[model samples]
Target chain A: MLTNRRTLLAGAGALAAGRAFAQGTGAPIRIGLLHDLSGPFAGAGSVPLSVGAEIAIELFNERGGVDGRMVQAVAADSQSRAEVAINEAERLVSQERVDVIVGVYSSAHAVPLAQRMQAQGKILWINSAIASAVLKGKHFTHVFRPTVHSDQYGEGSIEFLAEHCERATRIAPTQFKLGIIYEDGPYGVGVATALEENARRVGMPVALKEGYSATAPDLSTLVTKLRRARPDAVLQVGYNPDITLFLRQAKAGGLRTRMLIGHGAGYSQIDRLTETFGAEIDHFCNVDPAATQMLDPSRLTPPARELQQTLLTRYHARTQSNDPPTHASMGFNNTWVFLEHVLKPAVREGGGSIDAMRRAALGVDIPVGGTIQGYGVKFNPPEHEMAGQNGRSVAVVMQFENARSKVVWPTPIAGGPPVMPLPAGSPFALR
Target chain B: MDPFLLEAIVNGILLGGVFALPVLGLNLVFGVVDVVWLCYAELVMVGMYCVWFLYTQAGWPLIAAFAACLPVVAGLGLLLHQLVVRPLLSSPPITQVLATGGVLFILQGGAMLIFGTDFRSLGVEMPPMEVGEIFVSGTKLIAFVAALVGAGLLWTFLKFTYVGTAIRAIARDREVMPLMGVDPRRIYLVASAIGGTLAGLAACLLVVQLDVHPFIGLSFGPITFMICVMGGLGNMLGGFLAAFLMGVIISTGGFWWNTEMSYVVAFACFIVVMFARPRGLFAR
Candidate 1:
């Protein structure tokens, strides 16, 4: 009862605050642009976050705005905490009174915030929260995740490895030893489940499986276990920090393995890790989403490029520095994707209600250059996944060359082709 | 003693010695002033992170990088003692604990906010100067030697120095110590300063061995606290002995069995010994 009272009072206070912001802006619609502007995840976090909101606003205005009304984004950083994210969500929905809230992230912190968004009855679109359960869960609605889940990379990675790498190049599974060292979080767990299933189905012998507690005094013990396993190619499925630790310890201990590959979610951000660790970094591959190509600015369609160009220009202007074009591009892509496919058409169809917008989103088809990851944005109602099961699988295995990851798989998207038995065949000579 | 037990014993002692390097300052302050310096572990973390940042971020020379780091961590410790511990002397002990804990929290948040939660491993180019296959990294060897020297100097200070005696006097009784013209307050202040310096040095050594974060206090504090307790609280030999014992147990135990269970086994051994002898393994 007390909780109910507090909720009511908080609701009333929020209504008053929203009235103030509405009067100040002379706009009826509100959109919350919540993000993690601080901490470790903040590095890659803002690409899908900070810039995503700006692009949506431009698109909304382009299509005569929702309800012939102007939209304002209530942008704030959640700082990667459930409590902070929840508070930010409430501030966006109740206080700022945004018509929709977007850009909550990284599974460690997004779950509770997602719950709060549902409870608060806010229209929320998640740009880049990685756990598959968010899309798969039954309770999640009014929340649309346009980001790729962890397992999406597994099918792509397994296929790439089976077809291209030395260990799996033949019909027989040769040199098929597998080892996984992951961060032991939900994101790690999701990726691990998919990798294990896919690897087994593809005929790799499981040599060792271990979960390293980040809280472990040091990872020397885990690394030692890894060294002893001597797997053909050890797949280190962890965040950047853990990957850095694994590589450093492996080098220090004189551990040798044929290769090291990252599950799509971790250890991909540091563009110069190979250079940082020297020869010890040896043959490493990261399963990363393709880098945002809109940086070229000339390849995009008119409406999309206009929004993209403005965001790229404004982002540079506002911060006096360029935010990584990838996340900012993804962020913009999420809001604009929804606007281009769902909201604009919904308004055109005179279906301004929430159900109408969702219905429009269901049938929407997106093309390449429509998103930061360059995937077509479409959804089925029951699944609500950006890429439903049996979706397109694309994992580019990028190798370190003179310290930077040079894409070397998928032949087409991977700038170079994989010539196997690895450094045995000079990978750095541009394929 | 069995040769294996003797081996275990020796290994434990060395490991504890390394563990004590980081938290020696905490023992000094509490031994003299009855203030449990909780921020001691965080000091080590900041030192580790500073080492990572200086070498990796600033691209400073290894020697110059450490020189820059030591003063920084020491300065941070001194600032903490001044801003937090000093202001709460008259308050209740709980208040003092809360204030120091707050300082720990703030340092942790500040580290996260500034440097980020990334694990920075410099892979600091240190060749393992071998000792007949019991190889040691160059940086770890330097750190181990420094821990011994630092602890020796501290042992001498507490045993022979005038301020050290006054600090001991303050530990016995605050009011009586002042009657002899020794201010208990000054003793506390000096104790904190010395503690900060030692803590700073510990941080420098740890950065060479492990990845650092604002949460590094989490790594060192509990381990060191257990070391201090296992060595018998307030007994430097006890603290020092227990730290190495815990270290060896964690290392060897982790090496042989599950790494997570190593802390459990070490703590269990410490507890059994504490029960059999109500003090520590080497009770004062």
Candidate 2:
């Protein structure tokens, strides 16, 4: 009787295991989010980006979680250190065995994370590290970027300068001399190089290209040099501290130009910038990855608006802050794309295999206005030598007026008209 | 001289004055205790945060908040002296250095954990005072004047006051000063308090101009140390003068070349001066 009972239990356990395996729902899908959750970039970048990922996971799970199998999302803080990011990535992939890794704030952290993910044959949907080197001449099937690249930021900046500077300052595009100042780092240098390349392409003259340490005590001398150069406009790429110090010193030293534009980084931090400078931040322009819902409400597509509202509501409910955070919008949109286009497809077609996911990601061909950020998802193939970059992702230029930052470039989707020439008495007016 | 060159020089001088204020206290503690408070910059950082919390968050007036920063920092300085610096005073200098270094990490990491690394600036926007073509930022000028006055007061106290004499005597001969009826431990504690007060003043002045963050102290730390070394360790006046000179050199270097080159030139000047005068440029 005892032998018969033991045989029956063993048979039942075997049948349950086989049934679950046959249904392709034996184990839950694990997603890892790596971010600088406690570092310098946390307040403006990482925190919001993580929220975006969380919101995506929540919505995806709510919709039945990749073919009836529950999805698990886990996050680890990089502490804004590259070594920490490496350790976290190792744990996420080797220990937790996550299916996908998403969100890294800095290029220093992102580069190593990307290499690790590729070696592990997993997917990495880059949230913000837009260094051009990450994608140029390299094709990693597992590494894909949904946000605008640094080079694109440069190109977008010059294009905006040519289109808006001429109208705002009444200076002809050919006559305008652009002064470019960038932090001496990979992100800044890459963007600056792109700015120069695009300036040459658009027939705009670059008067001075200066690179400075982000932590330099004062920028008076740099401002003095730019003043002597007498550029009609100045373009800068810098981190938060550098941008804050530069603007303060420039204002103190009375450095004036027709137009002043920042290509992402510090400029994209709208709430922090306003808190620090109040009205002083007005009249400046920033060219950054476009968050379509952040533009004037009327311009947002209904679907995009709904997604944005959901993200903001979820974020506000969690953090209790007044305004919707900046980096989360991109984070949510990027994760959403991966879930909708890649993960669900792979789970259905190939039993949740990574190779299937990669193939699905490559074949993704969503048109513009389909994603929450108003960008399409079409990864370039090896023939284009741009295998993993989102080719259609375009950045927008925003102008700050009366404590409001609104997209004012790419006329078709502009939030408002660009305020040109700055008022005569303004701190940034052209000499 | 080109107007811009002249402007850079003037701004450099003012920047030096602002830089000097923070280093003066570090100079004092390093001199008397024979211990390098490696966490000196973090002391100033803590003071800045105190000012921020009291003024910005609590809705206290700026001056009152500035005044509140002093006692709080003084208490912290006293606590640090008792807890960390006092115990290792007799150990090897390396032990003292490492202990203080631990304090630095604790304070920085603590600030990051507690306050978070969001940039917080004192929103005192006094317009620049324009005289002809020269524009002087009101906040910077106020800091410069405060530094000058604070330096003067510190000089008078050190030169004339009884406790100041005891502190100096302790610095000159720590062993003999106790025999002279002045308690060395007591003097060190008092000196630490004074140093904390100075940091408080510097923080209050700087918050008007510069933003406050967790690792901000690191940004200002090395250069301030360089200034102290160039001024002659423990020599207040020397540090003060060296700061302005280095500031001018850096500003002019930046104007003529670039920002990194300016720092290189400043470091080069420090090396040349140290090699030529082992005691330092302004060391008595």
Model 2 lDDT per residue over B131-197, tens place:
7776777778888999999999988998899999998888778888888799888899999998888
lDDT of each: 0.62, 0.79
Stretches of candidate 2 exceeding 4 Å from the true structure? A1-26, A119-122, A295-305, A320-325, A382-384, B273-279
lDDT of 2 by residue, A1-431 (tens): 01111222233233223333444454767777787765455654666676677677777666666776656666777876789999988998889788788888777677777778888888888888888777677677789898888888887888888877666777878889989998887778889999999999989998989888876767778887887788888899987678888888788777888888988767777777888887767878888776544565444567766777787777677566554445767888898888878888988998778889888988899877777777777988755666688898878887877655677878887866777776776776855
Interface RMSD of each: 9.4, 14.2
lDDT of model 1 at residue A125? 75
- CAPRI band of model 1? incorrect
Output the lDDT of residue B268, model 1.
88
TM-scores for all candidates?
0.80, 0.91
